[model samples]
Target: MKNFSDIQIGNTIGPREQFVSKDECRAFAHSSGFAAPRFTDDEGARKEGLPGMILPGNMSLGLLSKFVTDWIGPEGGAQLVRISTTYRVPVQPDHTLVFQGFVTHSVPEERTAEIDVWIENEEAERLVTGTATVRFDK
Candidate 1:
């Protein structure tokens, strides 16, 4: 686990891959209350002006959040203060998603850090982009 003192500006966490299966997409849709056709049904998605069944913004945020939590370790190590994301493209099901991060700022005195986070498709197209702020434990 990376500690607060170990954080450095421009340090990147990953280009790690996660394959989002159709089943996983459907599961997230059901569990997260994003049962919109755009998320659950391909035909419904097309009717809704989407290319096909897609992942919800919240689900994508969860993926990014998990990435952060995994990086800085357990709750005792650091707490995620905030995260914000902008969806650029519909995250389709059954694609390998690439998660990435860059430490943009760190304040040792305040025990805080900010990371630029993103998720990209196998084609390297960015699906979500955001910044996450973390508060380190004393």
Candidate 2:
């Protein structure tokens, strides 16, 4: 677990990868109340001019959150305070998305850190980009 003192600006956090599966997309759609056919059915997605069934944007955010929290560790005494994201492209199933994050700034007085995060496809095209703020109590 990294304490507030251990976190520093310009620290690279991760390059974790997750394989997006059809079933997982379907499950996320069902659970998230997102009934968009593009997220559940490839044929429907094709009809909409998409490459294939796509994962929900929020699911991608969840992946980013996991990447950050995992890096901070359970005892890191850190909690996410804010996050903003922009989706650059449709994320389709069967693709491996690599998640990466880097600490961009920190405020020791507030025990806060600002991070830049992104997810890219196997071909290295960025699919999502975001900034996150986390606060550490310890």
Candidate 3:
């Protein structure tokens, strides 16, 4: 686990990659109550003019959140305060998505840090972009 002091502004963390699969998308859609055919059925997605089955936006956001927390670890004493994301393009199954982050700002007095985060596909197209704020306890 990295402590608050270990985090430096402008430092990059992770290019954690995950290959999205159809089954995973289906499960995420089913469990999240987002029963959209585009998220679970390739044919349905094509009918809707999509390339193939796509993952839910929230699922992608969850991946981004996981990337941050995973880097900090449970004992890092960092509490996520806020996060906001914008989906630029759909993420389809079979694509490898890479999650990465940059420490944008830090306030030592508040023991807080702000990070700029994003996810990119194998083709290097950005799928999601966001910012997160985490406060660390002394």
Please give, for residues 23-55, the per-residue lDDT of candidate 2 as tens digits.
998999999997799999999999999988998
Q: Report the Cα lDDT for residue 74, model 3.
A: 72
Error of 2 at 69 (Å): 1.2
Candidate 3, 22-75: lDDT as tens digits = 899899999999779899999999999999888899898888888888877877
The ten-residue window of minimal lDDT in model 1 covers 69-78
Give lDDT per model, in order. 0.89, 0.88, 0.88
* lDDT tens per residue, model 1, 20-52: 987888899899876888888899999989888
Model 3, CA-based lDDT: 0.88
| Candidate 2 ranges with C-alpha deviation above 4 Å | none
